[model samples]
Target: MASRQMQAAQIVEFNKPYQLSQVPVPQCGDHDLLVQVYAAGFCHSDLQVLRGQFGAALPLIPSHEPAGKIAQVGTQVKGSWKVGDRIGVLNFKNACGQCVGCRQRLRRTKRTDPRFCRKRQTAGFKHDGAFGQFMLADPNTTVHLPEKVSFEQGAPLMCAGATVWGALQKLKPDVKPGEAVAIIGIGGLGQLGIQFAKAMGYRTVAIDNRHEGRRLAVDVSEILKPDLVIDSSAPDASDQILDFTAGEGLAGAVVCTDSIEANAWSLQQLGNGGVMVPVGLPQDRWQFDSEAMVFRELTIRGVYVASMGEVEEMLKVVAHHDISSHITTVDFDQIPSIVERYADKSMKGRLVVQITQ
Candidate 1:
């Protein structure tokens, strides 16, 4: 049973360090689980939220990429889950199951009462997050973790893995299973994007601006076995990409960096009839030529958080393909310091914050 209060990393204000404090461990009375967090992924999204980029809740305990065992479940909760059940928490806390969008999609097989529909609350942002030793998860936003998946790998799957995989699943850019798909900015999301794209039977061309990242891409390629690696740091990267694409250009590209400049280039590199899905967030507005978009039918679009169904499909792909996460684990207390460093693009792969694992 959860005690009244517990350890949590809550931010007091903008630009201030996250403060570690003992706060009440909330109950799962609202058909939610009191998850004893085992491993929570430290995501770039966490950094974005911490810096107020997401602009949802403040003075908050911030962490969305969470996986853990069920510590407790509400009495009225209706599911096969019990205490000790392992599950993953997604970035979206709740979407109204009664709204036309929700009812048509997630609510089809789920609890359909609009009153139970959570139009409000986002864990780790509007609501509290899994940065704590214990966090709350509603039935709608939780994903069951497969037995074969480890806490470290499962941890990153909650966000980095799911975010990219979910994007690919939703966008479904028309590159055939064996055709090439270019990825920009080989970082946490980019790395996962490469893996998912490769696993989906798409040849991957990982593009990065730094020698360090290019070298890392080589290492990742050996592990993940992506088809092509291009050093975008070189001036001839676009030309090299053209050569690699047989002078045609990529079938599609998923812009995975938090930069408008990089995305603008991806827009250009994507020749006739190509789609570029922008999964990364940038502070500046994206600019592109309307003529280019119309003439070539170039697609530049954005993707947000994953749906519950999409999260399950992502997990299935992870299991069927056995895509592992190269993760670094840290104790719960290290989250603030680690998150700060992560904001500067210092941490690697996905950071799994140890809650119990």
Candidate 2:
């Protein structure tokens, strides 16, 4: 048989562009699926990996947010999944089923644990990812897409959507619906956070910088319809939040920016007994007011991506609420230039690579 070949954008060196070239198609393993890529979402983390920020392996095919149809499945794959099933790949490629985390999750809930995996790694960074015509997928890290969600919409949900979804989920067992919640940063993750907050019945505040140009918060407010939009570029951003909340500060805040400056402001905006969740990966060191935290009894926590069960639930919410990532889809071949542009001046919305139709 002739060797199967596919087009892939690969990073051969650190801080270099992805080389779009023909490579041998990866074969499906015992628990793997050969996914025919439809779309792949690019993110800031991709930039981090490309610049060796996370010490990512070189010659990587970068893009974890991929949605597509299954072209082939391995024999050991056991489930309702089948060839031609529309699905999205999870960022956590595979977790060891024998770990303590995995056992605990399996016993207590349907969630899958990405940590404590014997061989845990992100798909796009460690393994060949979705910037290609085809990629091998671990059936364990893949989820079925709902009929209402398009491949493009499902792509970024694999990571960005799941990250924020999991963060918002942290807001309660204690926090009640209709409590004022703020989403900081107003970028891709924050945009989705706005929609999720509203759908979850929180009085959502969309926070970001005042624009010299088109304002993301304003543009998104028209779509997701956040209850309030505050430009934090101005010094009165926290004041605006307090005024809106009637002298009490935010019940919860999700800080989506990587800037320590943004994180500090978000922490200050939290009300008494409020929780502040930081999702951004900042490069610099950060400090918080120990006195304020002690006096106010504020909680600062962090959230990674969602568990598999949470991803399913988030997809349902998204589909039902008609929520979507504001994505700019480009041809797969343009991955190199776009990635460079992203590092210098990031795009407003999620940038996606369309591999197939």
Candidate 3:
């Protein structure tokens, strides 16, 4: 029998529009699942790839956040995973089982953690991603989306959702119930962070410069009940944050923007011995006060994505808290316009492509 062909959108050249073409359906390898993508999210990383910011290889399929139903299951995949199962794909598409990240995590944590693996490749960059009819997914990185969550909501959870969840997880044990944490950048990731921080019982403060961002932060404060929403563009921004926290300063802060200045200020807003978790990557290197970091004993940490276990845990939290992504849906062919909106800073919320039913 001839192989099946599926439609996909690919970046044929850097700084150019994606070419929509038909490609063969990816075969399901052992420990892999073939998913008929229902929805795929548009991310800043995808924009970076289009603009040649990361120098990623050419002809790559962008959009790492995808959710769909299983069309085929590898023979090695056991029990619950079967054709027709609703699932979401993780960025860590696959990791070598022999790598330290996989083996050590399996032994110690009783789970497969791909974050530490050197050979692990993300779905959108290293392999074919889900801006298509079908995508091959590693079983280890796939998570079951809850029944109530729509494909659009579940898709962003794979990337933006997981990223913030992993960053917030670093606050455990240190951030007490009444302590405050500030989220800088009220975009897609920051919005989710606000929801999660509030649900986790932390006094949440949101910071952003755009009037829309400040408005969204205040909306979060009203809906999710965050403690304060500051306009970071204000000259007295840092003072406002300190004042809100009663001069003790934030117990910790998550830098969700790619601005180097925002990152530096995020570190400065932290109280003594506070943790600064940076989730976004900047084109330029971040320069902070070395002496202040040493004197305050502050810790700077970068969280990329959650481990496999962490993804599952985050899904549970989303389900329990009824968390959802604020998104606008577009057809698969509308990516170029969305990219333009992204470049012009006009996109109000996350953009998700409806790939298939």
Q: TM per model? A: 0.90, 0.94, 0.95
List the candidate numbers ranked by TM-score, top first: 3, 2, 1
How large is the C-alpha RMSD of every model relative to the true structure?
A: 3.0, 2.0, 1.8
Residue 22: error of model 1 in Å?
0.8
RMSD of candidate 1 to the truth, in angstroms, is 3.0
Can you write out model 2's per-residue Cα lDDT over 1-357, one digit (the tens) per residue?
987998999888888888898888888888889999999999988887788876766678888999999999999998888999999998776777777877777777665576446567678877788998898887877899998999998999999999999999998775679999998888778888888998899998988773511266555535567888878877787789989999899999998888898888888998899998899987777778898799999998877778788899999999888888777888977888977655444467688889997
- Clash pairs (backbone) in predicted model 1: 177-201
lDDT, candidates in the order shown: 0.75, 0.84, 0.84
Once superposed on the true structure, which residue ranges of model 2 sit more than 4 Å away at CA?
Answer: 103-112, 115-118, 210-214, 221-223, 343-346
- Candidate 2 backbone collisions, by pair: none
Q: Scored by Cα lDDT, where does model 3 land?
A: 0.84
Q: How many residue-pair clashes does candidate 3 contain?
A: 0
